[model samples]
Target: MGRLFMLDVPENTSIVDVARHLDDVTVGRIGPYMVIESGDSVSIDRRSTDVRHAVWYSCVAGIEGWRIAQWDKDALRTEPR
Candidate 1:
């Protein structure tokens, strides 16, 4: 499984929304974090979220059971650690 904990902030709202719509993904909350989990990889297309560079780069609050396999202008992909 892969888990991404995004900070619950205004700038990150779009990202969280996109994540919630992904296949086989689940979105939940833990305090100030939006927890996104999936059995396989968790990938979010940057353009889909409509976030600018600064907000996109700073959106990830934390992660677990996974590592960032890809993070660029195109997308953010996390795979099992």
Candidate 2:
């Protein structure tokens, strides 16, 4: 499985919601990190989250076992490293 880490903040809540909607993806917390895990690539739509540009751009705090496949105004995609 691949993992993505997002910092716990008001603006990042939607990211968690989006991650939860993916098949085989699970969302959990480690300290202040919102850990998202999945067997395949994971993606989240920026517009669906409704977060402002600043928050959306800085939402991803770290990555574990994954690399950024795509990250833009439209979406964020992470794949296995």
The residue-level lDDT of candidate 2 at 57 comes to 89
What are the per-residue Cα lDDT tens digits for candidate 2 across 1-81?
A: 787888888889987898899899999989989999888999899999888889988988888888999999999998888
lDDT values for all models: 0.92, 0.88
In model 1, which range of ten residues has the least summed lDDT? 1-10
In model 2, residue pairs whose N, Cα or C atoms come closer than 3 Å (at least 3 residues apart or on different chains), thus clashing, are none
lDDT for each residue of candidate 1 in 1-81, tens digit (9 for 90 to 100): 778998888999999899899999999999989999999998899999999999999998899999999999999999988
Segments of candidate 1 deviating more than 4 angstroms:
none
For model 2, the superposed segments whose C-alpha errors exceed 4 Å read none
Judge candidate 2 at residue 66 and give its lDDT: 82
